[model samples]
Target chain A: MTEKIVVAYDGSENAHDAVNFALSIAKAAGADLIVAHVLEWSPYSFLTKTEVEERHKRRKEELERADKAIVSPLLQEIQSSGVNVEVMVKYGHIAETLLAIVKDTGASQLILGRTGQSSLTSRLFGSVAGSLAQVAPVPVTIVP
Target chain B: MYNKIKAPVLGALASCALAAPAAASNIDEAVNEVFANSTGWFVNFIFSPFPGTTFPWIVAWLVVAATIFTVYFGLIQLRGFKHSIELVRGDYSDPNDAGEVSHFQALATALSGTVGLGNIAGVAVAVGIGGPGATFWMILAGLMGMASKFTECTLGVKYRNEYADGTVSGGPMYYITKGFAERGLPGGKPLAILFAIFCILGSFGGGNMFQANQAHAQLTNVFGDFPGWITGVVFATIVFLVIVGGLKSIASVTEKVVPFMGVLYVGTALIIIAMNADKIGWAFGQIFDGAFTGLGVAGGLAGALIQGFKRAAFSNEAGVGSAAIAHSAVRTSEPVTEGYVSLLEPFIDTVVICTMTALVIIITGQLVIDPATGLYVLNESGSIQTVGGNSGVALTSAAFSSAFGWFRYVLVVAVLLFAFSTMISWSYYGLKAWTFLFGENKVSDLSFKLIFCLFVWIGAAASLGPVIDFSDASIFAMAVVNIIGLYFLMPIVKRELTSYNARRKTGEIKKFK
Candidate 1:
């Protein structure tokens, strides 16, 4: 069985670099490349009863929007590489969801973008890469 | 009997009573009479005097509720105490969770209302009339009240509603209606409506009027006597400014203010207790001795028990369902976690803060305890005056001042801040209920606020008896409806609790911290 590589894609320029890096890593290792997109979501627990209903509607719209606007096109563009690839889109903490996917898919390595968030924000919140590096079950490669 | 009222104020009140009786007096007294008489029906029914004792059976309602919950939940208040701390510390909080505030903030806002005059004056009054033994019962009731708080807040969060604007509405109203609907039970709407009415009335009475009334009392003590309406106007203006219109952002700022005043008040109690460290044991001895014996008061043990439970119920308001409004806004997926966190409120308000106030009063020896009769000596005016011959805030003032002369000034500020913040919180609480009853619109909202402000003026300028009576009546009345709802919805809460407990045990509920 071929080893698997996971790419954390968000449609940002650095995400393109990450997909390319994962694609190359998959080729060199003769592995399958899995593109994973995490749509940011809150727990939705704060919403009022009325808001909760509307939030569900918005959340569906958001999932569809994320797939159509970013994930679908990105997956199609990457498919031209002609390597065996799969795409997964989910919602939750970006790094956590990506890590979970890596574990579930038995991926050997994970590649994500560096500095998608603003410098000040990443400094304050800590970079997602910085966090996943410490917790990921598999090795993480943050492509700049 | 009327000595606490100044002679001049008495003259003025008498004149107002005399002048109003013919024309406006009948209408005023009659309206008061209707509410006074009718609410009493409900009040008397709930608080019927216990047979062979002066204590009301209604106080037993909360006591029983607390006890049943304590046992039913396997003493969750104790078992969950450590987790309560962790939950509050944000160990289980996910920032992305749907909530308008954090655990600490919601607790602070709710605490802002509860940790006010009740801790300062209500405790003093209980100890004075019920003796130190009242302190024992008060502590017991507060501990037990924790379980009541847990049950209500869990239901509160479970039944809360989140709106599209990211604002959430919770508390007893939502729980009563939604919980019942979910359970396929009837009477949820009517019970919710009754609770809203009492809540709004309570907001106007205890939250608005009583606050201004006491603030005026303390103001006069510090700054010398001025017409209370003047202080009322100042307080009303501040309340209106903070409560109405924009700058709605001050809520977060005010949340911090409550804990500050609480710490200040509790810190003062600690210092005084330390100064009289030797008296600490003696104070506890008095408390224990008095509790069972009622210290020779009219009702004895029963009387002390009554006063303790009644005042603790009044102060912490654990079962009254107000704190659920605040706690429901907390950012946690597990509603039961909010329950665990909110139970800490009564523990802090009554058990810690109120107990400190009680201990300070006891250790300071400010209470004029009559050893011969085991009764507290009434002031020269033949009125109930415990601290330095002044009841209410003055009594608490005297207890603190006995240790540090300057502490009274601090006490005065603390009282004022406590009263002020309590009014602010109650304004929001009342507005929520008002909107629930009268439709949430600018007109109803403004009108309710306008009426609330008017009461601030009326509260300052009026006598304490009727206002405080209404306050006590309405607040306790809220308990009547709220406790009823709690009974119906408790099974649902149990389901939530059991599920959360199982998930927590299995580590499915991961702690971020």
Candidate 2:
């Protein structure tokens, strides 16, 4: 069976570096590459009733926007490469969701950027890379 | 990204913050004059008394409607109450559903909207004038109002406008229009239009102004008697910052803090009641005695009933159709689940929380009970006299402070949080109605937000009497139009309930937990 390598992507420069690192590892190991984009969302967070009502709509808009502006462009650039690539977009905490994807895909390795968007939030709440490095079942790499 | 959003918002808030204090004196009178003159006719028309009776027609309208709903729904509120709790606990929820809100979240948000000044200040006003017996009526009205909420919310989900964009718009207006058209009724559009108009007015009076008025009253209770416009301007500035400045962080912070305030308020109330543990029996005795006998108050039993129902209607807003908007957002394929969830709102808001407020006021010896006649003592104005010669939030504050001095400070914090959260919820409801009538665009949205914030100032600057009266009248007007639609569309709700129940019994509706 072919091995899987997962990379966390957030359309940041460090994310591009992480993706390139993951792609090179996938090529060497002859493994499939998985590009995962996790929107930072909390089902537990409190919201106004109006915000709650409009949440589904906003989620849909955000997903479509991300796919169009971030994931699609990356896919185009990487399609000509020999490695099999799959892109996943989900709504949840970045670290937990990426780890879930890693477990579900049975990937042998996990990779992510050292810094991405929402650095301030990461600084306050602890970064996704910091979280996954401790708990990930697979060997983890932090690409700078 | 944080700085990108904060810079503009802080700039706007700072400018308004500076301007409000500087122009306070003249702007205060100008705003008051414009508001009273423009809204006077609408208030008077809505509050016009029934011929040969002192009771307002609007209050009678709500009472009759709630009664009809109770009978028509076969007391669904009582029968489905356990199921309502179950639904709220996520017993039957499908987590994978595409709906925006969970049953618990929807119920919580709706409760936060309704469980504000109405429970605190409105209850005080009720017991202050109508006597402790008003508590009995308030509880009864609250129970009956449950059926009204269940019916409207069920219809709200079934008839809501679910767009391809994944958003929804629902309330009395949508149900009236869509339900009527499906039933082959011709007057749906006109009735829907009328309901929207009443809803907008209700939002302004009850949602914006009443909250501001009572928040100002509580501030005055803590501080000395300052010009209310100062409170108004300050509230208006903060509210304006959140609503128009797109300062979502403030709004979200307020929402998060509100639930804690509810807990604190209720916990403090329990402490006060425990301190007066000896008087619990006598306080309840007074409620029963005052309710039936009127205890020498003006209208007697009927007067108690009127205030009880009025306060309950204002507090829970069951038949008023506002809560339905909040409930409609729940993530349930079974509309009946939302209805069941919503039935818990009035139960929690009125029967539980409002009762606590009323009991606290009674047991703390706020109302002066005449020892000779076993009746409430009345001052020269013929209104029941309280210990501090106060009313509204002040009376409630006095009752709490009588038990624990520092409790008043906590009460002030609770009042501010409650008022702020309620205003935000109502602003959304009012904006929906505004967009429904004038069309949804930036111009209309901005116009309504400006007007709503202005009323916050106006509400604070105005006296409690007219402000409360207008608030009652406008909110009751929403019940008038909404109940008409409920009367027409209730059979549909009954059908939904029956089918849902049948499915649950047959095990077709699987329990998740």
* Candidate No. with top lDDT: 2
Model 2 scores a TM of 0.83
lDDT of each: 0.77, 0.86
Residues B225-315, candidate 2, lDDT per residue (tens digit)? Answer: 7777778778887888788877889888888888888888889899889988999999899899988999987688878878888899999
* lDDT (Cα, tens digit) per residue for candidate 1, span B1-513: 223323443355346444543364234345444445555565456567779766676787788888988898889889989998887676777644422345655565567778898888788768776778888999999999898899999988887887765456788999999989988999989999999998998898777777887777777777786666566667766666555633444544555556777787788789888888888888888888888876665467887888889889889998998888767765456789889888999998998988998898888887777778756665554334454567677677877887888887887778778787788778878887888888878778877876887678677765555666667777888988899998888888888889998998899988887
List runs of model 1 lying over 4 Å from the truth: A1-144, B1-48, B95-100, B249-252, B371-375, B378-387
Candidate 2: count the clashes.
1
- Candidate by candidate, in order, the iRMS in Å equals 8.3, 2.7
Root mean square deviation (Cα) for candidate 2:
5.1
Candidate 2: tens digits of C-alpha lDDT, residues A55-141 = 788877888999999999999999888899999988766787888889889999999999854878877888878888889998999
Considering summed lDDT, which 10 consecutive residues are worst modelled in model 2 chain B?
B93-102
Q: What is the DockQ of each candidate?
A: 0.06, 0.32
